[model samples]
Target chain A: MIWGSILGITFVVALIILYEWPKLKQGSKKEKATVVVLTGAGWLLAVLLVFFPEMPGPTDVIKAIFQPLGRYMEK
Target chain B: MIEKGRISAFQMAIMMYLVVVGTGIIFIPGITAKYAKQDMWLSPILASLAGILAVCTAFQLHKLYPKQTLIEYSVNVIGKIPGKVLGLIFLFFYIRMNAGGIRIYADFVAGSFFTETPLIVIISTMILVCAFAVHGGIEVVGRTSQFFIPLYVLFLLIIIILLLPDLDFKNLFPVMGNGLMPSIKGAITPQSWFAEFLLTAFLLPFLKDVNKGRKWGLISVFAIMFTFVVTNLVILFLMGSITASFTYPLLTASRYISIADFLQHLESIVMAIWVAGTFVKFSVVYYAIVLSTAQLLGLSNYRPLVFPLGFLTMLFSIWGVANETESSSYNSTIFPFFSLVVQTLIPLLLLLVAFLRKKSGRRKPN
Candidate 1:
């Protein structure tokens, strides 16, 4: 499972880089920066969520934050 | 100038129908029945007004800026910084909600069809397919929906007609037996759904004939309402109160199609067609986020943002909820109100501001 997941993710990462690298190189600095930041954050989130799913995720955090409000609304 | 593709008002209307019916058709009967029971059909009848309201608000805004999306025109009404802040909020909200939507699709597919497959596979594959369509931009998305919607309706009608033998029309009786309040409760969630026509604001600018945009938009709203009413009636007739028992009442109802025990369990065909609608549904959501983000950030093009946003969407979908109970609970309790504010209330407020700005602009010119 781990090997397959890693291989699949690696393939995806390669594809994205291959498609994006030239565009990034040719883009103005602001466009290049925007792509870099968004892509980097996306990769980080995907890796963390994919490899260690049991770790408390956004829904868990949001559910906790909204739990009190949700209870109040439910009432 | 950001989007080069041009689509007709009719294509926009079809896209609206797909967006409106995407998840609502499959999941609404159970949810509405939970609140309205036998009178579930009435909820859509009344709830359609909100959809009309949403489309009207979108049209008025489109009138003010026939060439701009909500994100782009928002700046022309407000100052640069606040406009950008609004744009940022819109981007995050869409990405989050769309992630939750994608999660719902994954949950349904995983729960019913592919128990052995990892939820991520179903989730990512759907997102990838939608991303591919979204990458083609609005024209491709519009044409794809125009192509698929007829086939989708045909299959849906097939399921409805095949189950006619099993339908108990009396199950829908004791008309409003529970009073109008429960129907109102059912209408509440659907009203939020109707408000989702706010998405049409994004498509309006790219329309070839802005003059007919409102007519087609309203037509699409009525079409959605008609589809909902028919679906709820079909579910009530077929499953009776047992409509609330299954997580996916439409899918369950389709499984009941038995002609000489030969045509039993048409779940595969139903699911395939449903995935088509959902594909168009999520594609629009993805397009809204990517295009809006690019516009907000002053980028000349939006393609670079597509997969990054798609990746973010998959993560949120994975992390959105634990199971069906959580998803439905969120939908019933908090999501309706949230959608009302985001899709209806906020847009209405923006329209007001734009109105004031228009009046002031005329004054200055005088």
Candidate 2:
């Protein structure tokens, strides 16, 4: 099942790369850098998440930020 | 300059309606019932006032800037550093909120129907569709919403009607018997929803006729408020206080639709249109984030950001929740306060600051 999902992930990444590569090439240096960096970072996070679904994401980060306040409100 | 497509004011109205109604209608009925009991329907009406305030304030900002979104014109109101900082905060807020919205959508679908499917699958699929729409720009999102809104309403209203026999109008009795404070408290959550109209700042700049913004803005708020009232009433009549027990009162009520026993269990259809509504919602939020980030970075286009953002969105949606318990608690408890501050209070502050700047500018004539 894990391998299957990884294969699915690879296919998706490939498709996105194909779709974006030309546009990324045509864009200006700033645009190219922004797109590549963002797309690369996003892709890396998504792939890691696909392999390790248990990895903590945004919810914990947010809960750490807001949960204290939420408890304070209840008091 | 990334987005050149312009949509008519009416289309903007539809997009606003879809954005507000997107994931809200699914869970709000149950959540409001927990606080307001039978008066859950009234909460939305009360919430509408704040929604109006949010839309109007965003409109006021738009009127001042005319051609710039909240991101661009914000710099002119405040000094450069603060304006850019606020703009960055707004971009982050929209992106994170969009992630949370997708998480809510994934949770609902997974909780209700797709028990066997992995959540990442659901989150990623929806994000891809939304990223595609966001890539097409705001015009596509607006036009698509305009086409889907009526059909969504028709089906939703049909389900509400089909459940009439089961509805207990007696459920609404003893209205505010617990007094108005609870209902007012209930209003807090929906107010966050209503304040989401601040998203209009993004659409306002691209409006074909900026003059009609205020009129349609109010209309969108009214229409959404009215839908909430109707859906809550349907849930009340069908389940009464029992509405509080169900996680999704609207979905639960929809399951009760049995016309002569042959027409029943049409929740699949409800789920489909809901997915459609969420698609619109995701696109609007995602487009707002992409456009804001592009403008903030001085990029030439927003399209490059869409695919990357989609991945990030899916990652955020899946992260943090240990299980369903964490998701639901976050949704009910902290979410309202979080939304109200970000969606309502921040925009209110910006509006106040803009007003002060206007006054100070006139004084400079002396």
Candidate 3:
């Protein structure tokens, strides 16, 4: 199931690049680089999530930071 | 201008209304009821003040720098490096916040209706639709939201009307029996929802009727407050103190409508409005994220970044929390304070800094 999901994730990423690549040709080098970097990062994160589903995310960080105040709401 | 599309202030108003009321209607009544109890209706009125303050801050910032969005003007308000850092913080905050919003939508759908479907499917499909809207630019989002508002309003009214016969007016009694503090505490959650009006900072720079921006924004806030109050009252009347026990109180209220057995199962209407409203909400936030990212990275166009950002948003929503309980608790507690800081406090400070800078610059001429 995990392998199948990874394959699905890769396929979606490839399709996104394929659809967007033609449009980026008219854009600047910086535009192309940013898109490539963002897409690659998304792909990496999705794969990492598939493997380490227990990874602490942005919400965990936020919850940690706001724990003191959040405790007040528990009442 | 990264986006060449222009929307009227009225369109901006409609878009913001849907953005706030979309997921808000479903989630807010229950959450507010948890704290405010019988005084839940008062919470939205209190919350509107935050909305008003957010709109005023965004508008004042717009007046100071008419041509730029919050992301662009932050660099001008502060210095280059710090402004860019602030801009990045705004971008990250928006992305995370939007992801949380989408997660709420997905969880509602999955938990209530599509029990068998995978959440990723639900999240991705919604993101895909929103990406297309964002890809079309600000005008498309504005017009699409405008197109959907009447239907959204009509269906909502239909549910409210259908449920009218069942409401127990006695539930409103002992108003503020706890002496206003519980409702004020309840206002904390919805206040954060209202503070989302600061997103107008992104839309204001693209308005055709710029002078009407603040007027229409306040109108939007009033409209949202009215929606929340009405929904909160309806749920309170229908379910009383039990409102908070259910996850989506309004959904439960609509589900309770079985007038003569023919008008039953109208939760589908609730579901329709939920999906439509959330689409607009996500698109607006998604558009903000992509536009700010392009500006932050100095890209010439924002279109290519849309899909990539959509993917990231989906991932963020999935990774937002482990389950529904965590998401709900976060929404009611930490998310409000986080939203207050980023959306309200930070922008107000930025505006004050910009004013002082202008004053000192004028003194330099002496």
Candidate 4:
């Protein structure tokens, strides 16, 4: 569960930064507030995922992709 | 004057060695063992000869035209249209090769350490790191390789030393029991990897001293050969016949390290070293792709393309194979000939055309 939150947080933060990079380079003041809000939202989501461990969630899609490879190697 | 970066021939050699020897250290032993069995060490020696030939061909081309990259010289050698077409082909090859390397690294990490990590995440993170390094250009890549190569070599030597106790000398016995054909066939897979030294064409123009280029190229090939030979022998000594069955024999061997039961599970250390090597390799290939693309398309700024191209590369790495088995199958079957056409045949053809054009100019009909 802790790992899931870390993944969720990292994914969100990375996406937000990637989105804001081009806008920051473009020097748009209107986009600056949007970037800050998105970043904050990303952080908030991360924290919620971390602390609220019992929150109902969908299955981890990433783990499903890798599980087969792991099983084969283990064998 | 075409390129601003200035790396010494020695730095170029180190960079090339780092790129060539990266993921192969962990995976080649198993791949070769599958074909050559106990004779796996011989495969790299044979592959090294092919590497030498490829490097020598590239060096001769560089010597013929010291100031121009392969992209530029191809135009001077062949007609502009033909040269541009060839350059495009090379650009595509490097792009695919870079993506393939990223895939291999991501797959290995996902298969071993980060069981739950998304392969896309692992691959994208690596591509992000490489894109940043490549944006800094060739000098940054060379210097980084110089700094990390020694440490990588040291770690490799330390691993070999630790595993020495577990090595069974008899496992290497009954040499050539299946005869030389298997080892020869095994050599084909790695020979493609060795031929990657052809990248020196892109790097040669940036080298500080053209004369040392060939010497450094040979040195890089020898260094790669030494690494492969040592790794194959170690896996054979430690895992014996079962080495072929394991996907990553070197990592497994490192995992088996048990000194007083305390020095176990050093696969993370191996992972760290492998990541460093991957960084250098990815940077080199990424830089080559960007520079060659810029040269081909007449783009003044290569920086803007870095992120978009990296995203595409990450996507390709994810989609390149359905699974690890397909990836390995591609490596063993199609990769050698693909590498030969790109690395050896194209460059050799360009060199010959350049020479013939010069000869025809000198002997014009009066």
Q: List the residue pairs that clash in candidate 2.
A: B167-B237, B168-B237
User: Over 4 Å off in model 1, which ranges?
Assistant: A1-11, A50-75
* C-alpha RMSD of each candidate structure in angstroms: 2.2, 2.1, 0.9, 8.6
> Candidate 1: RMSD over Cα atoms?
2.2
DockQ of 2: 0.53
lDDT of 3 by residue, B11-104 (tens): 9999999889988887888889989899999999999999999999999999999979999999998999999999998998999889889989
* Candidate 1 C-alpha lDDT tens digits along B1-366: 989999999998898888878878766777788888898999998888888988889899989887999899888878889889888877877887787677777878889999999888998899999989999999999999999988998998998899888888889789989789888888877887788788888989999998898899999889999999988898889888787777788888888788997988799998898889989989988999999999999998898788878877887776646677777787666667667767888889999999998888889966
Residue B159 error, candidate 1, Å? 1.1
DockQ of each: 0.44, 0.53, 0.78, 0.04
Model 2 CA lDDT for position B288:
93
Q: What DockQ would you assign to candidate 3?
A: 0.78
Taken over the whole model, the C-alpha lDDT of each candidate is 0.83, 0.83, 0.92, 0.78
Residue B264's lDDT in candidate 4: 81
How well does chain A score by TM in each candidate?
A: 0.67, 0.68, 0.95, 0.45
TM-score of chain B of 1: 0.97
* Candidate 3, residue B212: lDDT: 98
Candidate 1 C-alpha lDDT tens digits along A14-60: 68767877877777788778877887787777676566776776556
TM-scores for all candidates? 0.94, 0.94, 0.99, 0.83
